[model samples]
Target: MDVSQVFDLNGKGAVEALALVEAALQEQRRDEEVKLWFKFDPPQPGGGETLFQPVGRRLRDAIKHGHAVRAMPAQGGGWIVRLAAKVR
Candidate 1:
């Protein structure tokens, strides 16, 4: 999927977000083909932040161990991700 339409975010921010997604995918084993989708906060700071958050170290380690995460845009401008085993 192009993934560009995944969110309304534009410019460098969008690129950064996409990069994070890719990194998340990479952490999940050496799989070459994977799919993911999700929505993140629009850069507002508060208790009501968006559901999606950055890929922390622990999650990254888990992914690197062989966990694939597929995310998609959910209601309330958040993200819904599916965690699965890696193929390779």
Candidate 2:
């Protein structure tokens, strides 16, 4: 499933972003999907990836469980993080 909601965490930091992802993941269940869209620091790809490192690790774990995530740069700054898990 695609994520229709884009969380505007413009002024938030990586910690906040990670927290949001964690919270979203918690509510997710098997056969369900959770795609998150949020902003993080640095704007550029390098900084964005570094800032999202921890979050990426978490998402990687989710991937092992049949989940997936993607990150893209936003127009203004930061990144849009998308997390998803498909129903098996």
Candidate 3:
């Protein structure tokens, strides 16, 4: 499923957005990673790490123990994030 359709948790606040991400993780497929793309308004300098770190942490914490979460800036605008369980 597309991340937007599965996790469409658009909100005005960070806390609300994080909550949506957490909820989405619970419903995600266990065998495959979930990828998400976010676009920032006006974009940010230096990839917007400072703005996205907390959100990334929330995603990591929501996943299964030992699962991995990846977040990085996209070339043109916002961020790309992926969450997946670790291989045993």
Say which candidate scores most in TM-score: 3
TM-score of each: 0.36, 0.50, 0.52
Q: How does residue 85 of candidate 2 score in lDDT?
A: 53
Predicted structure with the largest lDDT when compared to the true one: 2
Q: Which stretches of candidate 1 lie above 4 Å from their native place?
A: 1-12, 29-39, 42-71
Model 3, 1-88: lDDT tens digits are: 2453333333335676666656655555556676766544433567343335555566456443544466565554445667675444
The whole-model C-alpha lDDT of candidate 1 against the native structure comes to: 0.47
RMSD each, Å: 10.8, 4.9, 5.2
User: Model 2 — which ten-residue stretch has the worst lDDT?
Assistant: 42-51
**TM-score-superior candidate, 1 or 2:** 2
- For all candidates, the clash counts are 2, 0, 0
lDDT of 2 by residue, 1-88 (tens): 2454565554566688678777766665545444555444444545434445665676667666645566555544444445565555
Clashing pairs in 3: none
- How far is 81's C-alpha from truth in model 1 (Å)? 2.2
Say which prediction, candidate 1 or candidate 3, comes out ahead on TM-score.
3
Worst 10 residues of 1 by lDDT: 3-12
